[model samples]
Target: MGSSLSTPGASNANDRPAVAATLPPAGCPMHRKLEDATANVSPPPSAETNIDPRNNIPSLSQNPAYGQTIALPLERMRSSIPRTLSDLSTASEHESASTCPMARGGPSRTTEETKDTWVYPSPQQFYNALVRKGWETPVQAIPVMVDIHNWMNEAVWQEVLRWERRYFNPKQSNLALEPEEIPEVSLARFQGRPQDLSPKARFHMLLGRIFPNVYSELPPFDRHDWMVRRDGWGAEEQDKLHRYVIDYYSGADDEDGNPVFHFDVRPAIDDLDSLTARLQEWARIKRETWLGEEQSSITKDAKINN
Candidate 1:
């Protein structure tokens, strides 16, 4: 009966299928069961199919973890960068060149160079000229003139202050007379008597009193003839005076033959009465305007109070 049970066809161990050499030991039944269960089942879809919680929640890279994310449009971004008058001018120049049939290929290098030549005068130079011309006042009064030129050069302003301290101030040493004592010489001397005194002498006496260093530094003043000539007088007498100073110094040759004539002072005193009057008028207007506006504001407040 035992021999029959052990036979291949009979109900015996030999009749069962042989376990593979690679199979786990029979002691690990749970592992064997798991392997058998999984052998037929497809693997759970890869982790890629499972949406990450981070993906559902906005990523810090896409949406910042802290602070508001501003969504500026292209137009708004372009507008945000502030433009200056110079930038606007450059853009206009480019636009003009692009639009004009004559400038079909855009501005040539030469054209660009020409455009570059249109530079405004230096403020320091303008202020220096004004100081030289005997406009003895603070810089605050002349915004239009200041706008035309730059601020006074530091060296020039220092020199101007020195002169102001020397002549205008009562306390400073080397001051010949009090500010009140220095006679208010009329502008008529230059306007009226162009031929009586030599240009050098007139400049020496007049400008010398104003800018001692400048008068002392100038060429013997006799070498300059056209500078004193008063053939073309006009309403812009002040302008003429400015031109005289500018032109005389324009080709100024120094003691060492290097160009040195760069002092301007007349524009400093230009339109003094007019400027004073205008400033006064501006103050009055501003005061009246403010008062009117204030009255309306106060009236509204009073009505609300009542």
Candidate 2:
């Protein structure tokens, strides 16, 4: 169910061009319309996938959907496994590490624009993670896979920022926030909850049954809960941690034969203030875009009559 962005064989170099046009504007959340529009282009299913918490590698697990069973002998698989850090190959010494992003600190390493940028795992560490997960991945593919893993993380962070901006820059929000207030937003941590359904899933399922055609998309291929810390409010709201949910969805293939994907990112309904802020943001956009256009059209007609 994972997109080429997360899957092993789906090369990022080949897939990105096809979906580049579908990407959202700077800091804006992905437009949900792509969910159905690209549904028919989904790539053929690969392995049943869930991300590794450490490096976010799209893990390959035993699934008949892959159509190929693990055939390597247990002894053969264990033979090449590095037992210690010293045994691991130095990524910098190899060519695979050249184009790939390193685990360097700061925003330069990731799509994040703040000091709290995400760090990509080193190629050696990424390989170690695959071995630990017992995946039958080829050594040559680690560079490509690691590239995709890091790219997906950036995509996830972008999704989170869409929600964070509402609170981080509340003055622009429709909510009644003080004009002087500026919140310092930082990522506290990331928690993978692949097995658990987010609270919103139940409500979506209920709605799907009522209107199957409207909400016919499958359950999220993967889910993540991210904790974001916000500070600099007033005494009443010192430092606060807001939880956000990211749902990964795969759609039909793109022109390059790579699967397209959508990341549904939003603040979890756990915080009443956040939920209210989200609704207000939606309302603000509706007024400024759809209703505002209608009003402008009416005014033009009246002026012409005069």
Candidate 3:
């Protein structure tokens, strides 16, 4: 009996042009269809496509709403680094040193080094020095006394004047009287004082107290007063007094056209006199020394005229 050909390996038994083996039924149709679909579809792109999570984030670089990020490395570095006080100080110092000529190289010399050394003389010392130099004068002396008087109380001066009138007035003679009745006696006695001071003397005395000057060589009696009181000496005497006072304070030329001393009582008495004398002598010497200069000046003028 011929084996049933429709069983296992059935295609081998059908010898009339034996059929080729085929793929399993389950794979044939579905696999070919899948392959055909895949052929029709495009292949995945080959170029790199970087997908960054940061790109998804809202970035200052791309968004117009956000400020643009600084691109300069220096700007980024500046933002990242914290500045210290020392850095600022160094920068300031550099700028300052550069701007200022003195500060450029190093510190400037101290006041002591650059400035001349000066030793100020004491008040007493200065006065002594002036006296040694010879600058004191009569007018200078008087102002000192006046200054002293001014400093004294007004009541004191009034009392002094009262006593002076009482003791020096010559009209009244009675010294013995009750306190209330003694006005005449007091006036007479006050007027009768031994030291009969003239107005000039009083004025000079006032000045002397105000501006004390040891080097001043004032006459024992007030020459100024005597001159003023003289019967015949009116305007001329007054002029002379005025001139003398002015010369004593402001200085002037002597008879020979030589400059005299300038007497300032600001200094102590001793120093003032010396300074005055020195100034006077200096003026005189200068005049004598410069005599030729004046003559030469005249000669030059004459030549020019000729």
Best-fitting candidate, measured by TM-score?
2
Comparing 1 with 2 on TM-score, the higher-scoring candidate is 2
Q: Write the per-residue lDDT of candidate 1 for residues 1-306, one digit (tens) a residue.
A: 111111112111121111111211111010212323332232333344322121121101111112213221111001111111122123222221110001111223432211221112222322222232223322333333332122111222222232333333334434355645432211111111212433333454465567665443233211111111111233343223221211112223333443222222211223454244334433533554456433212111110000
Candidate 3 worst ten-residue window by lDDT: 185-194
Poorest stretch of ten by lDDT in candidate 2: 297-306
Each candidate's number of clashing pairs is 8, 4, 45
Stretch of 10 with least lDDT, candidate 1:
96-105
Clashing pairs in 1: 123-149, 123-150, 129-264, 129-265, 130-265, 132-265, 133-265, 133-266
Give stretches of model 2 more than 4 Å off: 1-116, 167-171, 174-182, 235-237, 281-306
Candidate 3 regions exceeding 4 Å error are 1-179, 182-306
Over 1-306, each residue of candidate 2 has an lDDT whose tens digit, in order, gives: 111121111122221112222321111112232333222222333466443332244432222212223232111011111111111111222121111122322212222223333345454444433343333444454544554545555555544544455454544632243535534555655555656776655555566677776553256556777666655545554445677776655555556555555555567778677667556545544454456433222111110000
Give model 1's TM-score versus the native structure.
0.17
Q: For candidate 3, what is the lDDT?
A: 0.20
By TM-score, rank the candidates, best first: 2, 1, 3
RMSD of 2: 15.1
Q: Candidate 2 has what TM-score?
A: 0.52
- Let me know the TM-score candidate 3 reaches against the reference structure: 0.12
Cα distance off (Å), candidate 2, residue 249: 0.9
